[model samples]
Target: MSNNTNQAASDLQRNELPAKKPKKSKTLQQSDKKLPFLLLTPTFILLAAVTIFPILYALYVSVMNFDTFGNSSGFAGLKNYMDIFASSTFWNAIFITLLYTALAVSIEIFLGFNLALMVSKDGKAMTYLRWLLIIPMMLSPLVVAVVYLLMMNTDMGILNYMLQSIGLPKINFLGEPTTAFLSLIFVDVWQWMPMCFLIILAGLQALPRDPFEAAEIDGASKFQVVRFVTLPMLKPIIVVALVIRTMDALRTFDQVFVLTQGGPGRATETISFLMYRASMKNSDFGFASAGLFIVLIITIIISTMLIRFMNRSQSA
Candidate 1:
């Protein structure tokens, strides 16, 4: 009888163990819900401090007259903004920035597409060359500036040496204002075109095989299929790439800063470089902040429009 009772008690204990699992799982589920937020907390706080706080502070500074001497001459209202708008230098910088952005991005997109086409073929050599092309995009703008400057310098640079070897005159690339602007555009294209190539290549590779197969069966030529089907399908990716490259081009500074310092007489001066000079060199924080705010607003508006366009294309 005692052995029978022991066996019955052991069976009851085993049944109760299963019942306890619900309570344990409830605790785990609660922890799972909190885990993502807990993990994200530090990143959110850091971004708030670094990005959000600075932007807000700049807004406040934009409203007041702030000199680097820590002298806050009360509120200047929109005077700083008005002054910036009235300045020819500001307008010229804006023009230069737009022109540089357009030239660099357009040329890069065209060249990158061709490069992507070349490397899209299946082969070991082409695959290796694709990665080699990517190396330029991975380099920092400052490093690129230094390297290009060394190579393109008028007197004793390798490029001029090559020119002389070919019975051509040495060009003053960074000295003449026009050539300086063109040189900056060239460097930008060389560095960023790889990005456009990679994106377009990915889009090309992911295109639906069935559509191409159908087109081939329908006796559509390669160029016709690309024009009607592939390009339409690729519109969204192209837009995204162009928008990203355009924004980055607008923010050009480091390479230009090191290479020309906005010279051969402000030829390569961009909007970003203008703000940097105003804040750091001229010590006019208020004016700089106003200019920065204008840039921020324009960027926000343009980004919104581009994003909307991308969304529409994706949906279609």
Candidate 2:
């Protein structure tokens, strides 16, 4: 019996399998480390060529002088920047750009939030209405400007016709300074309010159900719920929308260029339009580069501040 037991134990020990070892070869490890870098190399090279190269070239151009017939004379050592800084037109362009940004962004945010609140409920009607609202966003900015130009024409315009039919005086929307500025603002609002509306509406819809339930249990009023709970929750989305819109607003040129050509006496001339005129119309690349570099610097600072603000909001 003892001999039989020992024989069974020996057979069991002989049949058991050994544990497998993990693969730890140096070649496999090296390939794994190189894979991500190899994948990123193409993207990195493209960015350097497209973005970095142009910026560096522009910086180089900004400090040079242009001779008659539009050739670079030589390095001017910040003279172009000094000249641009001393010019009143540059300051006016800056002021107009700021004014345009403030008014357009403010109106869009206000009207968009209200519109979002109105259409936030889930329904087939809302879905169709959303499609309608996004139509302007789908249209090109230049196309929108051209359409508005036709609509606001003095002799045979639809808006003037409607006013005349209603016994109201026809307003020259694009031919005067005050009205032209207002017209630009109204046009910009018409084109971009939908973007703000869509963003805010999405934010409203994605709101967590628990908070609203708690608010209801606490018997919070509708206004209170929106003011305290909804707005607080929507802050991050609002900041994101604002940053995007603000950056685009700072570089507004396409619509204004196609519509006004910075006309009606520079009323709607933004910094971007000013740059276009300097480089393309006037054939002064040095001046344009200097002014645009300043704009680029300001844009960088503003973008940094907005990113920092977003980080703080996330942390809070």
Candidate 3:
């Protein structure tokens, strides 16, 4: 009986002992360390194919002369870039692009902030209005341009018809230079203001209630609260909105294509439209590529500055 009891106790102790883990091989450990990079290989390959390859090709083409038939004709060195830089049209396009970006982004930011402030409340009506406001941005830019093109037609368009009905002379909206530029700005503001509004409204919603509550406790008026507390906190978000709109406005092509086609003697010719004309109209691919590189450099600089500002604001 004592031997059987001792045998049972030894069996229980053996069963209760922890099992030893098998050691991983060196190769397996190395693979585990590299798994994240291996998983990202496909994404890196895709970026290389789409982005890096095109940029490199553009750089190559920018230095080489291309024939009218789109065949590479020999090395042209910096001739293409020099020609583009010397052209008055190129400078004009740059100025117009900058002007458009500044006006559109500023107006959009101003109107969007006000609209967001007006509707930043808890109600079904505000929710529905927000959805309605975002609908314009959801439409395709080309489609918006086409719609405005029809509406702005001078002879039989709705705007002119209304003006004539009110005993006013029909005003040429797109036929003139200043009106055409302003009209383009109006269209851009109409379509993109909602994006700014949505972004600012989201920022407003996400802002901490502590500051506002504190201001209220101190018996601050609404304007004082907004001026002191709201604007400072919302600066980063506004800058983000500005950066996005500025980049987009700088590359505006669809509206220029459909509405003006850089008409009224290049009054509204943006850099993007100029590039299109260089490549498609004049068959000067080298010039177009050089222009593209210049624009790319400018865009990179602007975006870097904006990003740095955003970082500083956040850190502060």
Candidate 4:
């Protein structure tokens, strides 16, 4: 009886000693979302410092009238903008850029969409073709330019020789204005269309099969199925593709620079190429900075609109 009493006393003492406190939950309640925002503050600060500051600084510099020799500098207050508006050279460059953008994008979309559809079809042949199609995108843009330039050379070009062999006239590919433009367009299309094709193909492959099977049971024709089902589902992916490709195309420099150098009276000179000439070749930093700022604004506006549109479509 004494031993039992001593054991009970010990148990009571141990229980009374203390219980370890419980740890606080690491995760906050869903309502307490502000913690995440607090954690992200540094990222926001860094982005503003790097991106926002430069953009604002460029805009400030554009309004100033400066020259290459660093003389005749003063606050012009939109005079540079006004000059850009008045210059026929600027207008012509804008026109050609728009034309190139439109043609390249349209062709890329159509051909890429079709190629993606074909490749995603269930077959061994398509699988092999898809692998092969990715080769162009794997090559460097500079290497592509060099190879195309060689192929487009008027005197020693394989393309010209092939045409001549077929009893056709040897056309000056990179020399004349029209042919120069066409050559550049072809090279760009060849290089980038594969990328679009791959993107769309990935989107197509990721789609759930139920909608398609259900549509088939509902007696939907091929065109009707693609129109009502596939296109709607692929919208988000297509928007992503558009954003990436447009940004790249707008800043097109390597191919045009290597192939033509804006020759034949600036026939193939894009805005990017023009800015390079101004900043690097002519050493006109202030003017080039202004032009680059304009390009940046246009890019931002376009990207914002596209992202908003895509968000709305996705939500709907």
Candidate 5:
């Protein structure tokens, strides 16, 4: 009887034991590891097709010579680049591009920072105002340029009409070199200031309350606190905004195209406009390609410098 009872308990224990799971095969494990990469293959291919391929082709074309009819005539062996560098028009475009970028970005940063500071406090009116401010940025640059073009018209435009009503002289906004350049800057600042404001406001809101509390406890003045504490904390965010605006400003085309078309004696001709003229109007694809590479190099250098500065600020 004891042996039979022991046998019955052993049987019960054997029956209650869980079944072992099957081990995955080596091939199956390898496939599982590579699954993510396989899924991402399509995205990589698309990026290469759209971005990398064009860049490579442009580099190739930059070395070759193209006829006025857009036919590739043999390799020019850097003649295109030499000619572009030798051209005074190219230098002028570079100067205009730099001036526009610097002025527009600086004014945008200053106005955006002040506007952000003013509206940073919590209130319904501030909320509505913030939305209204963002509306300008949301509009397309081309659309904004077109609207301003009409408004700045000297004869019957609203701006000129208003100025006349106020007994002020009618100003030729886009017809004159100085006013045209400044007008472009004004339009750029009007449209993009809100971008900086939004970015800075987000940064301000994301900042830790501890520092401000500590400043308050130490009886620090508002100006001192902002200069010492807020500015230091906001450096990275400001640099990010600066880099974005700088790159966009450097590539400015629509406003110049619509408002001035590189007119008024090339006063507003940006590098982009110059390239457009070279390729489209002159049909010199090789020259345009070379110019594009030069612009690319300049952009990379500026971006690298800004990034290094940001890193240094963060480290310090």
Candidate 6:
């Protein structure tokens, strides 16, 4: 009876003992699952430290009549915002930005769409063409601006020489207000159209070939096939390209800054340009903060609406 009791107790103890853990590699793999998050924590902290802090600080400063040195001389409440609304310069900047964005994005979409279609139809030829297309995009925007500025110079520009050679009279590309704004628009389109083309081309390539093949078999005209099959399938890509291009064009600063410097009587000065002037040139920290927040809010709202509209279109 004592032996039986001892044997039963031993069995129970063995049952209660934990199973041997997995080998070291397995143990390490389980540990590694948590390591990615641990690693990401530092990045998250850094982003919050750099980005979030400045944004919050800007909001706080916008309510105050702070001077250039960030010295809080007085509280302005909504006075800064009210003044911003009352300023005609602000309205002009807004209008110009909208106009530039509209024109640039429109031209980019049209040209990019055509370029993407042509590239998609080509075979080995497209490989070289694609690289060529990407060169403008790869070049720094500042570099592009400088190159175009030299080309568009009223006096010694090669562009004018070429136009004169072609029996076209040379017009002031950057010296006149209307021509300057149009020149800025043209430069923007030239620089950014490649990106739009690449994006749309990728989408075109991703499409299954069966629908087009079927249309071909059914004796569908090329136009009919494109209208029915290609356009519908490519809608999402088109929308994405439009949104991205629009956003970039709206905040257009680098090209305009380097090339025109918002010159010809502030004709090309965008909201971003105005913000830069307020913050850097004039050193009105409070007003700059308010303007920045306003721009940020507008961007968020526009992006949100675009996303929602795209989602609905995709679902439909």
Q: In order, how many clashes per candidate?
A: 0, 0, 0, 0, 0, 0
Model 6 whole-model lDDT (C-alpha atoms): 0.88
Per-residue lDDT for 1-316 in model 2, tens only?
A: 9999999986665566342222335567888999999999999999999989999998999999986567999889999999999988898999999999989998998899988888787577579879998899888899999999999998898999999999999999889998988898899999999999989988888889899999999999999999999998999988878888888888888888877888789888999999999988888999988998888888899899989998877677
State each model's CA lDDT, in order.
0.88, 0.88, 0.91, 0.82, 0.91, 0.88
lDDT of 6 by residue, 226-311 (tens): 78999899999899898888878888999878877788888989998888988888889888898888888888998898888788
Clashing pairs in 1: none
Ten contiguous residues with the weakest lDDT in model 3? 17-26
**Candidate 6: regions farther than 4 A off:** 1-37, 68-70
| TM-score (C-alpha, index-matched) for candidate 6 | 0.87
Model 6 Cα shift for residue 261 (angstroms): 1.7
User: Ten residues in a row with the worst lDDT in model 2?
Assistant: 17-26
RMSD score of candidate 3 (Å): 6.5
Which TM-score value belongs to model 3?
0.89
Error of 5 at 234 (Å): 1.3
Error of 4 at 184 (Å): 1.5
Q: Residues 31-73, candidate 1: write the lDDT tens digits.
A: 9999999999999999999989999998898889876784688
TM-score, one value per model: 0.86, 0.90, 0.89, 0.81, 0.88, 0.87
RMSD of each: 5.8, 6.9, 6.5, 7.2, 6.4, 4.3
Whichever of 2 and 4 has more lDDT, that candidate is 2
- Residues 54-97, model 5: lDDT tens digits: 98999999999898899998989999899989999998999999
Q: Which stretches of candidate 4 lie over 4 Å from their true place?
A: 1-23, 26-50, 70-75
Model 1, global lDDT:
0.88
Position 295, candidate 5: lDDT? 85
Q: State the weakest 10-residue window (summed lDDT) of model 5.
A: 17-26
User: Which pairs clash in the backbone of model 4?
Assistant: none
